[model samples]
Target: MFRFDWKMTLFVLLLLPVLIRLGYWQLEREAEKRDLQQLYEERQSSAPLPISGVDWSDKDIGWSRIQAEGYYETEYNFLLDNRIQSGQVGYEVLTPFRTDYGVLLINRGWIAAGPRREILPSIETPEDKAVIEATIYIPDGELMMFGEETLSGEQWPKRIQQVHLARMSEALGEKLIPARLRLSAGSAGELSIDWQTVNMQPEVHRGYAIQWFLMAAALVVLFVFFSFRRKEKPNE
Candidate 1:
């Protein structure tokens, strides 16, 4: 018969559930990542469509190739801070492009920050009209303070930590299209293009899940080996 040490059993009981739970959690994450990659792949394979042709009701329009013709609001620009590219700290230049349909925030590209925090880089935006080919990125709704903004106060090429649609709208004195367009290569005003669609692959999550499950299995094996006892012969 097998005998279990109370303390060891209790330890296994406590730690096993945590290990199993972590494995399941990683599996769930893997599933979610797979779904996102599938969606991204489906959208990327299609042809570019006019920005105005898309239906607003479709919420999963990310990576949707799009084209738009408009003049950039060169006077007002935004610098998205803490954007890193090629292991160098920089900012993503977000310029307002006024289209006939609506005003859209165009992610031009990454620009290196200067030696000092206060000294901002100079971005020369052509005042002339431009037709840009880009991808539409509809970000998820964020929980924000009722009236708070992430902008760097009243300043040209304002630095922002986050993309708050309502805050940007308030700053621009008008409502924006709620979507940030990433300019394609060779397009007007486009700079360094280093976009990472999926930061972590599903395989990574799957590997983590396997590790957690293996830990749980090892714990079970050790518990079983320690708790087992050989039958003893009867004594006279």
Candidate 2:
């Protein structure tokens, strides 16, 4: 014999789809992460290209390996605040580089914030013409993250939450290449170099999917147990 409860069944019917959908969503993310990592590896193996030669209109300029022969714009510099490395809070050093092709921002890498925020680290920029090899990295929605005052300040090294190409171009009085060149390890003027293609591993996404699915299964089991009932004989 079976017992049917319309209210409980309706509630489950509405919720089951949502839980199952979430599980599938995580699985989709897992697959996408795998694809992105593969692309990164492939790009890394290729030979480096000149920064100015590549077309900037492409959607993914983040992983480009490029060479720029130029001198660091010593006067203007930016320190991206709230960067963390090895459990220590720090800042990312960003210096403007003037190349023959164009002017672009170069991320020298992370540096400790020192004992206090007010005490800025002394960056050693090369006054002479030098060449650097690096990979381009443009964060998503970088424009919205900045404000009108982000590029403003009397200080030589401005502290900012994020880089805005339009604001920076206006401040520096030069149109930049629209991405930050992350200096490669061992490159001239490089500091700590540790960049990851994907923030979360694909396996972690799959594990989350399993947890959501397990909850959905438990819901089904409870609904089934309540639906079944034992038949009793009536006494004479």
Candidate 3:
């Protein structure tokens, strides 16, 4: 059912460098994220709280202070250029909600395209108070032409699929939530939640790491097979 040939080998070798480069990038990105997560966890442990375990005054809640810190944000073209699945586009829309314990950052949903140059997307924030939970992330800031910040009172129901938490915080104007929450869509209008942060999962990153390595391996095997092929003797 499967066939292997020298042409395949040559092709693989030719592509090996590209595959390796991509794998390296993924590894690097994942490593950077790991470091950030570790640092966040550490800060959470040593950081002082405001007498009470949680600070409800801020619009959002964060383990540490709700200050600007760097994180990863995916580029728009990177998503399309890579031919990612449909529905993956501009920004990962995040909203905040109050809770008994504290605030949580809920990833309300994804916007398909960039928000209009002069407009902001209509995000139905949860009016009912509840604590929000989410990890702080920074955007990659690639392939984007960020426009001047949009002022409040300009309500446009367009989709703004871009993330710039710092800028967003300004737009929001309330104390601004510290962390983010990834919401689950279900039967009712309830904000779905996962107590554990998604980035904490080793399996997801490991699986991706394995994929990049496998592609590199495949290329090498192909190159070797083609290199060893023997030529036929000339006919007398």
Which candidate wins on TM-score? 2
Q: Best to worst by TM-score, what's the order?
A: 2, 1, 3
TM value for model 2: 0.87
Residue 166 displacement (Å), model 1: 1.0
Residue-by-residue lDDT tens digits, candidate 3, 62-150: 33432211221211111111112253434444543434333334454444443454433333443433322233333333456567544
lDDT of 2 by residue, 68-103 (tens): 898989888888888889988988888888888888
State residue 1's C-alpha deviation in candidate 1, in Å: 6.5
Ranking of predictions according to lDDT: 1, 2, 3
The 10 consecutive residues of candidate 2 with the worst lDDT sum are 138-147
Best by lDDT: 1
**Better-scoring candidate (lDDT), 1 or 2:** 1
TM-score of each model, in listed order = 0.83, 0.87, 0.42
Lowest-lDDT window of 10 residues in candidate 3? Answer: 74-83
Off by over 4 Å in 1: 5-8, 138-152, 229-236
Q: How many steric clashes between backbone atoms does each model show?
A: 0, 0, 27
Each model's lDDT comes to: 0.84, 0.81, 0.45
* Model 2 lDDT on a 0 to 1 scale: 0.81
